[model samples]
Target: MSSIQDLETWEPLLRLVRAAHAEQLAAPGGRFTGQISLGSWTLPAPQPRSAPGRALQVVDMQDQFTAVERVQAALRADGASGVSYVVETGPDGRPLLHVITAGPAVEHGVRSPFVGALLLVEGAVPEPWRRLPEEFPGAAPAPSADPALLERTLRERLPDAIGATAEEIAAAEARLGVTLPDELKALYRVTRARWQDWSGDYAAQERVSTAVGCELFPLDGLYIADARSRPCPWQYAAKDAVVTAPDAAVQGLVGSPGWIAFGDNGGGDRLALDLTPGPGGHAGQVIMIDHERSIGAALRADSLTDMVVNHRHEWRSDVAWNRPPVVVQVSTHSPVGIAAAARPELEVLRIGPTGAPVSLASVAGLPRLRTLTASPGTLADPLEIAGLTDLEYLSLGAEEWRLLLSAGAVPRSLSAVAIDVPGDQHPLPVLDLANELLALWDRPLITRTVLEGDLGTDGKAGGTR
Candidate 1:
């Protein structure tokens, strides 16, 4: 047997678990579950608490640290990334250990026992990230826009302010690969707004903020807020939709190449000039990209001049368009059923646990449907998903995936996949199912190391090898 599979290699870690969960393991059918990797762990060991006037020292949890280090060293030697383990009492009143290593389908550093989302097709991004803003020929500068007035107002507000040179402004524009707007250039020409120029003066910073109506970024700090700038994981990103109302002033998009970020709202939100405006918007309009949101920007003002001179900082919410939702969830809590969510605009569909099994017949031919996630035992027939020819991402339970794999009906259009493993299910079957999926795509399979050990009846490790 390999060193990793040797009983002695896992004794220290087992001892640590037994020490912490003795009473729980002593109960009938009681089990302890966790995951561990070389860099991190999620064991159920007791955490060291800090006392008054003193911080916790390494000695407070030396046993835990040492035991975890031993397991990590063995994993490194065995060339494994992580392992999920389950501990339960044997019939003879000793602890039995089952260590399951991760496969390529499982993402690294994920503490969850089940395989989440796995990217099968390389370099495929979520649908929203691939979407771009629609062109509006009627878009033009706002009537309130006056570069001369904006520059004049700043000069009067900060007469002694240091401004950037024409050369400095040109360098910034070149670096960002986009021409700076006239109003933004004028603002920078009056004051560069660099920290070094302010010389650590809080009053000077306040004066600049008062003059510009917001915290201003230096010319060199300007960047195009493109879709790539705001990145989200595939699991969450797949559920988002890009929708813009007909009368919206700003386009609803993940991010835009035309958005030039220039300042902040003092609360981490960004202020940018939108050159590519929506149908009812003006060119060079100011928009606030809220830090808390992943998609869309709120219109701050019609133009930069209007924002600074008129103090037009009122935030208008995105217009509510009466269009069908692009993402839909079918559960007991949802108002709409699968039939209602079967529109051509549907991109993501999720089926949660319901009273009866749901069928995919309603949403079978959705042209734009790219993602589908279903809970275990929710689908009436797992084979019904074969009709979803356009699916780019699919997540199903182990049994559902097995049915698909058995019939050779796994969607070829899939770019990624995930298997939802139940807590009560053993890892051996889940790992096998994961490998089968990986094999279908010619991806690397998951490797396992079985380490069986005996923790004596007295809660002490007895096995040496």
Candidate 2:
């Protein structure tokens, strides 16, 4: 058997738990549960208190560290991420230890310790990441855009600033595979913004920031902030919807190919020139891509010339106007029912615990519906999910998944799936269900080894159970 399945491998950790929680273990119907990984842990063991004269040292929890280190070593040897553990009093008044490791489909560091598997088919991404912006036929450069005026302003602001050569600008265009916007080119022509040009001078960089109204990136640093550039995990990315307001200046998208990132807002947010504008937007409008957000850019200025001349770096408004009810959650707390949420614009629907199980018939034919997440026992009939033909992502409880699997009614159009394991349910059954889902897409299955042992009546390590 692998070390992960060997009783000896877990004895040290069990002994530490028994020692720390002796009183609790001695109590009637006592139990303890926690999870541990290479980098982090959540255990019932007591933490070390700082000494009078000094802060707490690693030696204070030396025994705890050593016990966890052994388990981590076994995990590394077995190519596993982490393990969850359960300890309960046995008939003989000794502690029983159950170590559980999740399958490959489940993400590590999840607190629940059993299941929340994300089954992704090869090369498949969340729908929002795959969504491109809607085309705007009448989009054009802003009226305030003036390349010559921008260059002249920069020269007037920084007389000693060195500019890029025409050859350098052409090379950048060729490298990026897109023509640089005229305003961007003009800004760069005044100062290349290379650090080496300033000779390690902090004041020079500050002066450039003051003149440019933001921290500028060098010509080589400029890149298209496409959807691929700002990556979010499938669970989060699936919930987002791309919704552009008809009268807005920026198109709501994960990222745009036309968004050429030229600088930052001193904070981490990016400043980009938007080439793909919304219906009411100008092609060369300046937009700020927030570092905290995964989708959409905020309009910072109508034009780069406006930004530089008028110093319009402050956000006009971060909120998206004319946003439709694209995401709907149906639950006991939700204001809208499933029938009320069945709008054509609805892209995501989440079914939480409700007074009664809901029917999918209400939201079956939503054109833009791509994501659906239903909590355990929230569905009146799991088979009704087959009607959601456009579902790209679906997350449901294990029992609900089993109903669909037994009836051969799993959605073929799904790009990804998730099995939500609730409470302290055993990992073995959850792993089986997760493997079955993975097999549908020919993906790898989650595998685990079980180790069983006992803590003796005296609160010391005992032989295998």
Q: Model 2, 1-465: lDDT tens per residue?
A: 667667677777777777888887885467777877778877777887878999889999897888788888998998877887777676667556767665545555364544453655666777777877777889988889999999999999999998999999999999999999889999989999999999999899988899989999999999999999998866777888887767878888888888899999988999999899888888988999989988888889999999998998687534552244798888999898889989998988988998999999988888989999999999999999999999989999989999999999999998778777767674556667877888888776665443345553333344454
Looking at model 1, the pairs that clash are 103-446
**Any runs in candidate 1 off by more than 4 Å, and if so which?**
1-15, 23-31, 35-41, 48-111, 319-323, 422-428, 446-465
For candidate 1, report its TM-score: 0.83
- The 0-to-1 C-alpha lDDT of every candidate, in the order given, reads 0.81, 0.81
Model 2, residue 276: distance off in Å is: 0.4
Q: Model 1: per-residue lDDT, tens digit, 307-340?
A: 9998877888584422357778889888878889
Residue pairs in clash, model 2 = none
Candidate 2, which segments miss by more than 4 Å at Cα? 1-18, 21-44, 52-54, 57-109, 114-117, 317-324, 452-465
Worst 10 residues of 1 by lDDT: 456-465
